[model samples]
Target chain A: MTASSASPYQRLHVELDARRYPIHVGPGLLDTPDMLVPYLAGRQVMIVTNETVAPLYLERLKRTLSGDDRDVREVILPDGEHTKTLASVERIWDALLAAGFNRRCTLVALGGGVIGDMAGYAAACYQRGVAFVQVPTTLLSQVDSSVGGKTGVNHPRGKNMIGAFWQPRAVLIDTDTLATLPGRELAAGLAEVIKYGLIQDAGFLAWLEARMSSLRGLDVEALTDAILRSCAIKAEIVARDETEQGQRALLNLGHTFGHAIEAHQGYGNWLHGEAVGAGMLMAATLSQRLGWLSSEDMARVETLVASAGLPVTVPAAMSADDFLAAMRLDKKNIDGRLRLVLLSGLGEACVYDDTPPDMLKALLDEFPRA
Target chain B: MTASSASPYQRLHVELDARRYPIHVGPGLLDTPDMLVPYLAGRQVMIVTNETVAPLYLERLKRTLSGDDRDVREVILPDGEHTKTLASVERIWDALLAAGFNRRCTLVALGGGVIGDMAGYAAACYQRGVAFVQVPTTLLSQVDSSVGGKTGVNHPRGKNMIGAFWQPRAVLIDTDTLATLPGRELAAGLAEVIKYGLIQDAGFLAWLEARMSSLRGLDVEALTDAILRSCAIKAEIVARDETEQGQRALLNLGHTFGHAIEAHQGYGNWLHGEAVGAGMLMAATLSQRLGWLSSEDMARVETLVASAGLPVTVPAAMSADDFLAAMRLDKKNIDGRLRLVLLSGLGEACVYDDTPPDMLKALLDEFPRA
Candidate 1:
């Protein structure tokens, strides 16, 4: 069916000059051929999804993409964050080569953040980059990973240590896919949606607080609004700073501490958003210590995080030193100085490299543990 | 020493807007810290070289880069075309992380094509690309790979099937290194020099024809001039088509057939330039068959390739089917059509996707076997 006849959706563009593309958010987008067909680089399409997503949506996506003139294939990788490695991407590359796909081909990432990240990265380097369309199935991926064009696999040493900022031809968010999402996974995704508010939009945070129940209940309208607003904020930031030169680093609001948690716990143990949820609270707490946020502001952050069903405390086993060790290797750091995205106010995030070491250590040591 | 006092060098820019960088060709550039220090992105520097190149120039390079505030490290990988893989690049990332090298870190690729390609790719993906300086020591790399931003690793299925077009901060070519290059390797470098002539500059081809022995004998002036001319032609093409949208494909005149030969023989067996040498002759012959070149024109290509000490035949074991199979997977092809860069005339090339299969099979079937 054509987009005109399909269910109504909100569209936003990541304004990247020549690489600008649209992100369409609505239900049943997976079954809409016109939404996807135009953005394809060529007739060859490789659908990279996880085993978890294939049974539910693969055939439908293939049917939408397949035609006599097109050669559509799929590589169903094993699921989870642990599988986000170069080895899995290599599998995608191997499959592309095995099928004799050329530079003109397009890769359709049809799963969550892991699938999208791996597939986008595979496309980024396959024949020095091919076109890729992000079909983010998870709520987390929809509101976050799919829009900004940051793609890569995880390293044993750190999260997203190796990757590229390759923009996608388009992003098709089929909100209907969230029906199969697990409750914990859904909560994980809400963490990022909440993140948009904490980092850039105070009004959105208030709106999210009011609609938290609707969001958690999977109210289609609430979820759609959240995704739209989140994408709008991210797209603006990415357009201004596509490669994270300066302002873009502010998007990592809780990522530095969150990465430390994920790395310390070992990836795949703590969901990225869960770690971010707790890490955001940690940042808020640190901001409180630094006089950037008031006690009431920190309380509000804690309440919002806890209400979203995300952890608001640090992983119990991690120590201040463990956090420091991992944070030192974060991609945001430079010249051996730790750079972190911290809130100057409820909605004002800033990248600061001057977080006093002693103060940071105190906060990490005192932060509540799960 | 400064570039001014450091044995005068020729410098050219790869005009890529904000990403534009310079290519410096001269002797003793490795020892000139001023040439490299200014291009570095930050204080952390990681030099990625191969075992072969490490013993030869690693110390000299390290001494030049080391300082009180700078963190200079090295990852010496096993040397060979076979070592160019994601696994090797991972080692570079591993070392970078171990050293806590952040996004501000600069990667110095101090070796030939393999080391440069792998290091450049590692830098391209490390923290979504850090700055990299190409210090290509081999003749072929100085004239070809190092100048262009095309960096990648080989897959068992195809050569350079996985990679990126990440530009370097600068490329420093120290001609003095050629004095230690192996005879076979020197000849291999000459093959690419001859290619610049066949693909774009007939005048340079004639010059090469006249000074082939001088170049082979490592006459510094002749080699420097050849490198300069070759780089200028490549920079012009790359500036016009950084992503190989059109004009840049001309540079791959022999690479399609050359890649087939390399894939069939297994990588590392035949040097890239050696394969391209043979591949160029094949393209010239096919151009002759297609009525684009005179018989005498084809003979000149053969003589030039032979004089450069490059093979003028396909791998003995590869049949027409082998060539067809490998060439089919070439990155240049579109929608399963075999795109070959064939000579339209001496010093002129065009990407033709309409090579009748029957004619391609005939040419491959009849081409001489090494």
Candidate 2:
């Protein structure tokens, strides 16, 4: 194995036999390019990033990929949730084809969750699925979107409404990219970071509480370690249940409520992390109402989110009915019945169907604008 | 087990475990919807067919399905290959949502390869993969497209340019649909039947030579038995190599050349089988020119294609170079090198790479004129 492959973090493999790929994390790994070389066996490489991320490190990324064999190219998509549409995916396909790319090509996603999801979905559908590399530049993508094989473009009816479960050939989480991100974006990303703790990693959440300031300040070691821990946990969940029949639902700790808030707010109004941040708070409160979580445990979640600069309050204009209607439209719902990942305790969640809307709506009112 | 499931045919499952699906062939099976009750698992059912099919047998299929406990609905797509697009897939999704169909709902693709492929692709993308049943209603679909889980829409650049290998929960091949199919379409379907014999079943090809006339007359036992044999050979091949990494390429038969013809003639201009029909003749001739096939073997291929009333000659308007260019753009091309699946013996074939373009251009010129 190359020195680049032997990192301090644990590496998990999703074995589809030859299509297998690895998830790598930990500090001082991004600057090292050798780990990425083998997967880039094909000569041409297209780096897909967005406007919000391009200004910060596109040049440095280009430099790392500079080699005689590499015909490096870049396409900077407009940054936002709105850009995750078929039109954008077509644009990427057009560029790859115009660049003389065939099946033997690699597409590199170089942004946060939206960029990774869209680029990975394009990779999944392009020529009936090709190789893709994820270089996540945000905390949400590093810990969540980049690790799982779930990739897709969205429909007006729902988020990730159209897509495939195409895993990336490799994921490069350069925590260094965290340095220049907008503070709100950082806060939004932290909501996802906290989610790993809520869904399947309580200890990780506690670690985030003690290390929030270091992460926000871009202390390389702390952020890298946090991302590595998150990826390892997610990789285990995905390996056993790639199709999300059971255990995988736990990963959606705040997403059922989070997606409703994002859709109600018209996608871009709230960062995914922001809606998820506030949504997790609401879910925790509902857990308390159900006698599942203790009041003391709920207070701990609120304190951790606040210290990480995440929001713990829902927007004022939104009403409980809108949240319920939006939740009904969530992709997670089965047979028109709303199914949610409700916590029985921290580090555990069960997907409960037959959620009585009135009870949910009534409890949803309890967390209103306090 | 039902009497049919206990047959030697039924015990031979596709056998990919979770991705495993049974291909039920024989007459009267469509009316026996009881065969499908177990697979439905008490979920809602949506039958996706086309105008060509719905007018003929929708009520009967529904009556058969009425025995089940779940709700049954129908979505009719426009007939023909032209409708295999992202636009068409959106309609499936919209229909499901408008009808409040969710994850637990099972989609039954109730037409030819177009319906099976597009519906299967729709299921793969719907909520990031849902369970789908392939109720293949064409001779071509019964043998080939229905068995392999490869599903997707075409990109503007090529045919089947976008898709996935999302397997079915089960495939119900009702032989009765073949009786109502036009003779021309039935002939087109035979191209795949002939492909099986050409690839690895010389004895089956010989059997087809003897029974082609009976099959043409829609003799139930002869044609149904032919289809069962073809699907069995394909199912066994696909169960081992679902992704086309190795042995699966042998299944391509005339497809390397066939895809070029389909794309050059503009998909719908020629039925997929018509293209394969002509393409197979060209492949045999190319094999002869490459010093692989004897004169008698080449003659036998042309004789079978001619008897099926399918085109055994290329369109005069498309030049050899144009065909070559189209083939290069095919997903089958690897690392800019052309890979042609060539015949070695009467029934054995191999994927040959870096094929000589001049040889192909010359053979294109020497094909039998209509």
Candidate 3:
């Protein structure tokens, strides 16, 4: 562990110019006024959250941010992927206007990935962009979404079909917030954590293999280590390719297949992480067939994801044609060709644009009964 | 004139990295396919325009862009500032989705500032941004909005209150399009053309003074020179400060008051150019009040604006309090203090945040009966 992690907390820096910010991971970070208040660019702030998260954390965060001089307001939406729409974002805009928020006003996203994406996009468009801070209260958000600059609401036709690469001013991840996370949501977050290992860090995969049980048991040290490492990996990639013209596409390792599942089954039917877990396994099947990854390693990859309580099997009702049609609609596809991220080995991945259709079909066949 | 302008048309380059693009200013450009087709990034093109502009130019543009292999779509919206809303942008989004446009697909904005703003903003958000080209047909768009990377829809409370600084791949300015433009709209464009001269180019202002009659007569050469010089000046400023952190704010020499007028009068009630023309005079009044501009120089500025057929006086109905309240709501203000872009001298502007309230009050009183 680094020296920062050796203390009660860990702080990692995202070094993108002008947009450079810190991600602080520690216990009870939400209670620490110093972690969030100093990052506010103005006295006005709007905390955007969803119903599920609002009941648990909104009032507490409001209390922490409230003061005689500050103007703090809260805007809440119904909790679900269906709600990640332009209409939902209009509520935030209307609220900000009602509160007379200006260009210098800050938007603080105080929930999971949905809140973060919606609020980040709101800040990006409000007065041609405003400062925003991410208070990610979910493991999924802290480890993935909140660390990177991608933010948007979804269109009915696709997940994250609309968005911008608007980075947050800072990220405050309180590990204590994870205590309220449901098991399924927690497992969803681990899928992305495992992704960092699968894509760039072989050693991290080995480490995750050893600590899976501790993570499931809600061990604070394990959770902290997972989030810190995941954020560090994401921060590194995002800093290098903020606009995703190149290497950053590798971060979408399972997202093409995962998004297809989410869109096919209807968003929110399959939790994003669950679909990604199963999708990663499906991608591994293709990688094995292509001879980049051995069959044994592919099975091992499946086992790790399965052990995390994430679905390794695609839903039984979806046929190969169904998956094919959905995958073809992914935004990553260019000129009618599906570009996918496949494992070169257990700990390494690369984007491949020349995937054979037969191999994709063969891989989909194996997942149909799962 | 530069060698490029020696021909029947002229081309100016905006040199911002990656976002660097050419601004082509000339006559009869809409009749030429080479001016547009070469800049398209893909076979799929969505041309966004408005009702008034569509009847006049849409079919001609479509005819120029059409081919057996290319997929071209057109989205025509109601013509006015009110239609520049999130709901209106949703129409473009829906049209793109319905036609299955992808990341590589290019959006071509084919009208005035409103079309460019909405289309550019749609391009910025669609699939986290796709390539777009601007075919700015109006004078205001050619000189100002189309050159800078600002794109967005207006909020109910303010003009251009929601947007992104997403640059287009290229800008195609056809001075021939001005032949069909309404006299009022033409004058509105002149307001911005004069703005460039007022802010950074006294020599350009002198040139405009000599050629104002020719430009008002829509003489192709005069119009072309005015646009080419104006775009070059804007391009330089935009390249230096893509985001309005410092120098870029100087480009808003009259916008702080102009937006206030537009927002208070209800956007479209006062044309953007008219508001800006009057607002520039108001800013000049403040400059003179602060002793930065001599009374004689300020009157010359007002005379130039009046010659262009734009309002040089604030409307009689707006009280000092009304203008003050409206200006206070401007996004440029920081920490509740209005930051006026005041003329330091003829052809030189600077952002001044410490403008005395009394000076602003005095300027408003002067405009009540102009």
Fnat for each predicted structure, in order: 0.96, 0.63, 0.73
> What is candidate 1's lDDT per residue for A167-277, written digit by digit as tens?
999999988998889989999999998888998999999999899999889899899889888999989999999988899888888888999999888888899999998
Q: Which 10 residues in a row give candidate 3 chain A its minimum summed lDDT?
A: A1-10
Better of 1 and 3 by TM-score: 1
lDDT of 2 by residue, B223-305 (tens): 87788778888887887788777898888778877787777778888899998888888777777777889999988998999
Give the poorly placed runs of model 3, Cα more than 4 Å off.
Answer: A1-8, A66-68, B1-8
Model 2 lDDT per residue over A173-236, tens place: 7656777778998888788778888877788877888898998887877877777677777777
What ranking of all candidate models by DockQ puts the best one first?
1, 3, 2
Better of 1 and 2 by lDDT: 1
A1-370: candidate 3 lDDT, tens digit per residue:
1225554568988988777898888988888787889999889989999889889989889989988589889998999887899999989998988787889999999998999999999999998899999999889999989977899988887788889989899999999999999999999999999999999998999899999999999999889989888998888998888888788888988888888788888889999999999888888888888899987787779889989999977777788888877777678778678889999998888889898878777778876455
Q: By TM-score, highest first, what's the ranking?
A: 1, 3, 2
Residue pairs that clash (backbone atoms under 3 angstroms), model 2: none
Using lDDT as the measure, which candidate wins? 1
DockQ, all candidates in order: 0.88, 0.56, 0.76
lDDT of candidate 1? Answer: 0.90
Better of 1 and 3 by lDDT: 1
**Ranking, lDDT, top scorer first:** 1, 3, 2
B-chain TM-score for every candidate: 0.97, 0.95, 0.96
- For model 1 chain A, where is the 10-residue window of minimal lDDT? A1-10
